[model samples]
Target: RNNQRHSNNDARRPPKTFMPTNGASRTSRKELLDLIGNNPGGHLDESSRFKFETKLRAYANTPNVDPSDVLFAIGSSVYGTNISFPVQEQTNGSKPSDEEEKETNIIIDFDYMKAFMKDVFLSYGVKPVHAETCSEVLIEADRRGIDSHGFGRLKPIYCDRMDQGILWPDKPIDVIKQTDTTALVDGNLGLGLYIGPHCMQMAIDKAKKHGVGFVVVQNSTHYGIAGYYATMATDAGCIGLSGTNARPSIAPTFGVEPMLGTNPLCFGIPSDDDFPFVIDCATSVNQRGKIERYAREGKDTPRGAVIDSDGIERTDTEGILKDMVMGKCALTPLGGAGDAMAGYKGENISLIRIELFIAISLGRGLNCVRTKCISVHHFKSDDEMRSKKKKSSWDIVK
Candidate 1:
């Protein structure tokens, strides 16, 4: 039964996503508008779905198009499993076999995407300015083709979280400590999608004054795209750095049961061109979410992405997910296997990450609750340590 359900979905394929850019020529814009205007019957019923309805409505209102035309344009953008374009013909003295369309084209106005996101959040009762900032972070990810972190998250963030009371639109992100080069931000348990950027910008401001800045945050929810914050730092003429530790998905090498989060690391380097050089990656060989994505598509995963319940590598995406998340399996570290095969190096890096999470955990006041926390019980004040050194010198002379 499960296999049949999976096969049925695989026959349908995923929907085609649309994203527009800023520099499209007028002719291209007109052609796109006309294409959409000419085809309006294929959209998923907007009135029945929460997130998609909001998005379709927004896409419909983009500048210089009729409401009727918007519906047609959206309809034309629909894609399914059977949608394919021929590349060449067969050659029995005839042409070679045709090639399939290799990619999908999506045109989204960056500005319009932002405005629509902002409107959706506000209509849903999020505060005005917070809505705008959240929109900026989410849409920027779409512009970059990072769909997992883009509009795809709107439901969990705004809709589902609203249902769960996890999203606090009115709660403020408070800065508890500040110096020339550092600050501590408390999220008040607010959405990280909103607070992450706030804390990062504070870091950027401090960096401007001291040539480097750092901020530690606690009680924050998921920050949409790590690159958004990192790029903000780079835009200020400094290299931007961002990382966040989440619910654990990684297990220590040789040890079982998950204890480490995917703990993504992101860096944005300034470039001479229009776009910054951005690299955002999860520390594990693969993100747990990516495995879920493969499972949804009825595809097999590549080797080395995961281990099964019995500690054997497997290609079945769903099996990998069930094993990893349920504590029956754990992901491989950034490097494969043990110290002899760079396992020790991966372990060392995880240790460094532990220190980082420790620092964040400490600032958040959650470290004390850790069952097996790293001990930091012995410490000497600077003056006491200096006096001890002097006394030791006298003993040596004696």
Candidate 2:
């Protein structure tokens, strides 16, 4: 939902070269076989499998290779790595042609890919732990085939946000409130990527004791993936739920200007295995990423994603931007434009998100007051009550 990073870079650029080849290119049976054979474990871990795949697609559009030929070539090489062929005998009982033999060849080097991504994140001023987690999340998404939220976003997120003060390096998250099953976190203008995970951990601990725990936070920047926070609870044997309010970019049904954010909700339920049913998605039918995707594939937007200056549905990219920035055209909710298409449901969810944001803000205020209170007359009777109460050391806002 947060496309603030890459979507604006075209206005000032070094005219970078083409993107790298993606794994989606027609992968040969041979390559799959080689990868399978060489990596007998089958790229199954969170970091090795999913994250690696996510990084691959990002490479496809980077400034090193032709996007068109990369996938195809990689696919052919894949076929060479793992395919089986039936040999034919000539009158002389000859061997198969090189083309047939090529179907069983192998040609990828994974270490280089890892190094490439590492260099990229480090260059963006990401703290080592943060960069590692970011890379893992992206590649894991790719491996799981969720290309929509993978490494394709890494460069913009770390580098661009650092420039904007949206992502800070090594800033400690300030905790403003804490209780048994609930707390409020002030990110202190730090990266939500780090603060979010920390907050979720607090919730997980509380849930272990109270059956359910929830934490609402504010002033946190965009966390890369919502699933990352929700899954933390499920991983610890409890159902996990996490949601965040983002900068406004989505329009409520029937409204032209953006008022509600593309607020995301994520739920994680643990199953028998490691692959839990974790759903991470935005409230909007289509997000800023989807818009950029249309521009990337040279395709038109689907109906209902955006409206023009005249309040009519439109697919033109420039027009979409005009409506987004100047024309007051905004993104619709999960349902289509009107009540007939379930637009009301989207509005209902928006209200829920708004309530969560408000609850967190209010809760923080209450906690701040509690920090400044004392036992008063119980401690020193009437004499202590007459003295002016000292201000709380942690109450920065007051």
Candidate 3:
């Protein structure tokens, strides 16, 4: 999912116009709302509608995306391979109508989907602006092919968190410290969709005045795809970089414990080409999100992508997912197994460590980053790592 404007598939060619129309019958816009969480507060206000239209235009015009190169179409899965859409299939005791085969095969309109998601959040009492931001960031993931982080997360990650009273939708973000080129922020357990953009914009503002900007945020939940935030900088004609940590899932080379997250690092650079250079990937051979995707697709995880507690490579998607959470299996770092592939250089510098450093400095633990973490400790060879079994974990500061 690099920031390359690759050609979209011919079968899923985007409609010439994106102004949401109520033409599709399989999943008409009106019927589409029926599946959006039964949200009692079920309508986008005029302000939200206007904002969504503007947001749509903004997304279509992002520097890292080319309208002509995007398949902003519909599909069954939110991150469908064919750029289709997602709608839950309805199944009661009624006979299956040709259309109601349980929203299975439903091709939802993009705008309709976003509006529906927005209303769902609004009903949950999220601020209108935050709701809009949440919808925009998520749809961006689906559009960019970062399916794992796309709109599919709206329910499981967000709705559930908010329902559980953990994800505060309207909490005030706190800026604990600031400097000419850097800042530390606390998300107050609020939506990352809003917090991420807000902090990144702060950085952009700083960069405009000082030629460089950096921001560290903690206490935020999934903020959608990091690439989208980087592109915000690219859109402003500046280089953008971003990273975030996930649930600990990777093992250090020579270690089987999942002490590290499948942290992803994202980079966006403005280019003369139609699309900017947006490179985003997790440090692990496969990230937890991709593994979740594999499970949803009913596919096996790739061999070497993960290892069991015994350190044997595994490919069972279900088993890997279960083991991952239980800390029984660990994702392989960017490099493959063992020092033969230099897996010890995990993601170039343990971004997790950098995140820890920042958050620790702030008196809390913030999670996010991408880099191979290595200590300055000189070692003769891989043999040294094996021989010094009691060696301390490599410090990422170096």
Candidate 4:
């Protein structure tokens, strides 16, 4: 029976997930759990099996996940679940208590993490310089506090895609057309990490010469984070702006199926501060990456962030991700689910750019298949500063 099979191979599962950062490779997990919980072992029961498998799959999917991240990610699932590991080791021994152990974070050095990721890319036959460039972009997400798009994406977004033949890490970038201030490029299914920088640098170079530049890329896959490209322009002392289109996940205001990607937009303005003033966000209220992070944490997606096939708000992160990719569910737009808060505005903002890019690119020469958008918003002159302790200067006009 299925029940008997579930009981057979799952007994060692819990203990086998010992945190690697604890230097515990020499100390097997079974021994630790035995010491802590009287060597308890049994197959996962049907009810708890669902929870256990969910957490286990997430753990297996993200192998290189940092121990610090896993502390919160699988910590609660491990300690509180009824499947196994019933007791926590005490502070009586030289070993630290569960509380202290949870706080013990083995942080990865930034350079080391970058070097490791570069090696991962290189292993896939990426050119050394291109691999390094991709690594830098992925690491910058962590540096900028965008955990959703950081190294967590490596296996699923890059390595797995490469494995499945969805991404070509070694393809050359082709410039389809070029003008003094504009360009159309084809990534040839290349790594977005390489294509993104190459395109942004071209834009930056043109900006230096002409005060503005426009570059559109097609056939690229996920490009790490949008902020990385926008910041590149800031580093060059020019206002940097960029966006990327991704696989569709967002639905229209009243529609049920997905018709738009998360459609992130990011820009960086040089400022007097230590870092440039940068704004980066997906047009959807909850982007797919954030949902993936939640799934990794064994947590539910935020309510109203996603909608299922029945037109109901869905909170199951894993299910929503699966359904969205399959067109059975869709993400709510930036404002929320309905027109009550103008969610359609967000839906339009994310979708129209893709059409515009494709049309423009195809009209010129090659087809535009990339997923990002960029546009300017202008504001009229307004009142000057007012005291923070009092009403604003604009209040007088009102």
Candidate 5:
């Protein structure tokens, strides 16, 4: 009887399906939609959607299990039952495949990641305050799902440059010129991730006192994300605007060689709703970072987003990265390659963003094009204005 009972238990044991795999898992559109509960209203925006898909694919590929199978296992475990799955046999003591090795990733806590980044910056002589600020900004990008601008950028964009002595850490931001409501700053070639918040804060302060503020920074490195500075003003009950010109990578409409940065224009406005109104994007059809992301994932950029030297649209992700840096490829404008899509309009917008700071300073009769800029505007609400008027009139009569 005891032998028979043991046999029955063995017969009912669930088979293991989990196995190490060689390649990164790819995600289907169907799986993505399902993860979001198939709710149209819950669909992610373009950038967020790409990030979500990328992360999902990375996770799915990490264990080399079919996404559905993973889901099935979870469901079965939740319902207190074991599901059987066929297991692949592997040779004893076999080394992990190259693809599997490449797919492996270490999962770290958010705080630990920030601490590590902080140490990296500190080791390079960044000021304690600046190091914390920079680390927070990068981590915030990851938290907000903007992976392209987040922690992933620390090495390539900031630290590596610092190590090469190309990026100066702990440099003072000098005020080259200033008025009650406007100023010109020189970043001393320091990390813009640190300089950006400082300049925006100066603008916000001036706006509170003078109703508007305009601050510009010259000789600055790439600021992490333009929207971050813009939202700073909105947080302070003011309208915020920010933009920057990068090393040129965009070609004007009907032309092939690069002449414009994938210049971004960002705006933030206070609202009565739960979230502030914010608009932030590159004037190009797609930002270059997205292409880098596609290349990292071994995927092609969407069709028509870039053109090679031959003036032909290209989708070769890795090739495009090489070509663009060598000036053999160019990003399209917001409307895309040609006039049928009104690409010229996007070209016009790009020019506007670059010219905005120059024009504003020029209109104020200052010939200072050396600095990139940000602006802030504050206004009194109608009710407050009415109340102030009533009080002023009463005081005048008295």
Candidate 6:
């Protein structure tokens, strides 16, 4: 029965389109705009429309793909259905040959995906609330078009870590210190998926009492996305700031050894516009997870983004991954390979992120260490900083 359903859908799928060899040019903008039509639900205004077009041009320039095809995929994403985009099909970690065009993906409904994930976590001894929290965070990533951190990491990162005893499934998150506007927490080596939301909520609650709140957490595993916590603050009518320090994978300027993490910093600000102002990004030129994704699709990592042990640029996806694990390769700083590009600025930002949590926690006499910080600043109705009378919320992070 399932096989029959798959065959039916495959027959209805649109034929793949041909990709342009060169990047999209200015002359192609009008054609691309015609293909996408007006923004659905007015989700994007003129400024955003211009930005989206710029992004499409960049994607078109990516090796072996057409800009129009990528734009079609974007359209499909917006409408919540397949819209005949010429996206390259991916199965497992391998790309199939041209003869495999008939192959179709098994589409699972969103609710089903969430339920399955919740069940999987429950079976691993996770508390019901914690399991649901983790499931929702992962699903939100997919809903917002961030497949890299979504269900893709459910098994490999979260479940496997739980099985190996690296992440405590139902562990209690403990508070080591607290004040009217500040807090220090310990995650008990639990999943950050659960800990992150809990702490962010605590910060929001504190902001309600005072004008601003700051919370620092320690000993947590990978959180789904930094933007999630920031979004939480914006939803509560407050400005949000969040960042985390991870295992070192990025090298500082003028240094060959990996010394700093790809520490991500995120901000969410309330606005009168259709969408709130949100910015999220890592301090490095590119995240290691992206390299893994490219490797999965049998594509090479972009040039100048990675360096081997001898400080030479490397592009082989598989080799880079191996070398990164062995501490023989490191991601470049945000500006690129050297000081001339101001890569040192990214290095400084990462160090500041680490210091924020460390210095603040130590001042409070908290011994917990492993940096993750969430801070919120609430506003009153008559606050001078309010942008306008309108209220809307949105999130953006890379």
- The most accurate candidate by TM-score is 4
lDDT of 4 at 338: 84
Q: Which segments of candidate 5 are over 4 A away from where they belong?
A: 1-107, 359-371, 375-398
Model 2: which ten-residue window has the lowest total lDDT?
373-382
TM-score of 1: 0.63
**Local accuracy by lDDT, each model:** 0.55, 0.53, 0.61, 0.64, 0.65, 0.67
lDDT of 4 by residue, 63-163 (tens): 34333333333223222222222234456646566657644434444576677678767767899999999989988887666778877777668876887
lDDT of 5 by residue, 134-166 (tens): 988877777666767776577667865765676
Give lDDT: candidate 1, residue 244: 64
Tell me the alpha-carbon RMSD of every candidate.
13.0, 15.6, 12.3, 14.8, 17.6, 17.3
Q: Candidate 1 — what's its lDDT? A: 0.55
Off by over 4 Å in 2: 1-118, 321-323, 354-398
- The estimated TM-scores of all candidates read 0.63, 0.61, 0.67, 0.70, 0.67, 0.67
lDDT-superior candidate, 1 or 4: 4
Cα-based RMSD of candidate 6: 17.3
* Residue 155 Cα positional deviation in candidate 3, in Å, after optimal superposition: 1.9
Q: What's the C-alpha lDDT at position 23 in model 2?
A: 42
Native RMSD of candidate 4 (Å)? 14.8
User: Could you tell me the lDDT of residue 381 within candidate 3?
Assistant: 6
**Model 6, global lDDT:** 0.67
Number of colliding residue pairs in model 6 = 0
In terms of lDDT, the poorest run of 10 residues in model 3 is 374-383
lDDT of 1 by residue, 212-301 (tens): 776766556677667777787778777887776556566567654566656666778888998888787776777765665575456898
Give the TM-score (vs. native) of candidate 2. Answer: 0.61
Q: Write the per-residue lDDT of candidate 2 for residues 1-398, one digit (tens) a residue.
A: 11112224332443322232444432432343354346533332334444335444443334433423333332222211111224445577898688764433332222333343454455555577765665665555554545455544544455456655665656776667777766766665565555666677777777788776766655556565677666666678777776655555666677766766666677778899858888878788887766755654458888888755466877786568656756367777889566778876886585454423332334332111101000000000001112133334244233
lDDT of 6 by residue, 1-398 (tens): 00112346564765444545554544454465554455332212455546565555555555655423434344333322223335565767566765564343334445666776787677677889988999999888776766667765676688667757887788888888888998777787888888889988999998988988987776677887778878898888889987776767888887878877787888999888877788878889888767866765569999889987798989899999888889999999888878888988888787665533443433321112345666482110101121223222211010
Give every collision pair in model 5: 25-61
